[model samples]
Target: MTRGGREKDRDDPERKCIATGESQPKAGLIRFCLGPDDQVVPDILGRLPGRGIYVSADRAQIDKAAKKGLFARAARQPVKVPDGLSDLVERLVTQRVIDLISMARKAGDAVMGYEKVKDWLTKGSAATLIQASDGSERGKTKLHPPEGNGGFIGVLTAGELGLAFGRERAIHAALAAGGLRTRVVEEAAKLAGLRGHLPTRAGGHDGGVTAMKDT
Candidate 1:
């Protein structure tokens, strides 16, 4: 972790992204390994054995790396990049973020539904606020985010947030201070950067009533 208590920097170990000639922290980059058939497989957890190729988490960076044969150059061997590599990576990262949130919820460090979220916020137990990207703007505006640069995440969709809470859908949620909260913010930040939009905080009802959409 960094001195301020953030997760370790991805570039700290100096991994090179195939797209950009520059090397950076591994946490901000995605790892890939050449499979038996020479296919490039994403190593989301960075635990895959083998010399790994790295790419920045941004969609454009991944696309350029694949299109320009940068993976082969980095790996020093021919590597087969599947079609839609960016989409695949995005899906994997999104799933990972959702899974982390789900774990937090299961551990009693997370709460969904407007009232529960408000209770946490009112009690000063909420460390971060999460709202769906596609949720109604007027509905999201009702809740104020915690006071801090990293206190709000507005990337995941209602359906995605629902996955985290094990519900049909969710528009609002809050995470209590804990290890899982930190992980969620880190992963969600990456997702937000890749997806290219900040979550909306525009609308909601008194008592945390959120209008969830099916987008």
Candidate 2:
């Protein structure tokens, strides 16, 4: 059986953001580790070999950490913050989310196109609904997210979603409940933060959708 809605794993551990000074689950933060030359490198996959310093996923927080030398402070040594680090993290996170969705598709846990997605949603086989941020608003609004929080993703462009589904372009898709689906939600949220605004089920911080819920 599928798990309930939401992405964060209770046992996954947590970290503190150097810029915000806020402690939260690791899913909502970005990890950075020092390179051989003591340069700060974003461990987008959290696999680098060094003690990790974390910052919130928001672009502003990352910029603050860079501009204020917070990463150096967190690392307790001088470190080089790469130029356009925010853009780097955003690109990595976007790729990560896309990769997760691709894996889900290969696993038969994801499907694209309006009818397939609608079928999956109505049948409760879909735990999450995904629509392209560039899709027609009228078309996107015809489908609601599955019945749960964290069940909607509307940040990716049609071209990006197409890459995951092996199509030229795709406007809508759905993810079946599983760890991959959850990972997609978690990473996509981080990507959304860095994007400053994204499209959710009912819309996103770019405009509407208060608290990330459809209400």
User: TM per model?
Assistant: 0.86, 0.89
Model 1: which ten-residue window has the lowest total lDDT?
202-211
lDDT of 2 by residue, 1-215 (tens): 11112455667587888998877788788999999998888898888898999998889999999999999898898899899999999999889988999999999999998888889989999998988776767777888897776778878877778889887778889999875987898888888888987445744234432221110
Q: Per-residue alpha-carbon lDDT of model 1 for 1-215, expressed as tens digits?
A: 32112556554676766777776656567788988899999898889889888887778888898999998888888778999998898899899999999999889998888777788888999989888766777667777788764578777877789998878888889988866887777677667646754433542223333445432
**TM-score of decoy 1:** 0.86
Off by over 4 Å in 2: 1-12, 204-215
- Clash number for model 2? 0
In the order shown, what is each candidate's alpha-carbon RMSD?
4.8, 5.5
- TM-score for predicted model 2 compared with the true structure: 0.89
lDDT of 1 at 118: 81
Name model 1 segments beyond 4 Å from true: 1-12, 198-215
Worst 10 residues of 2 by lDDT: 206-215
- Supply candidate 1's per-residue lDDT for 80: 89
State the lDDT at 91 in candidate 2. 92
Instruction: Estimate the overall C-alpha local distance difference test score of candidate 2.
Output: 0.81
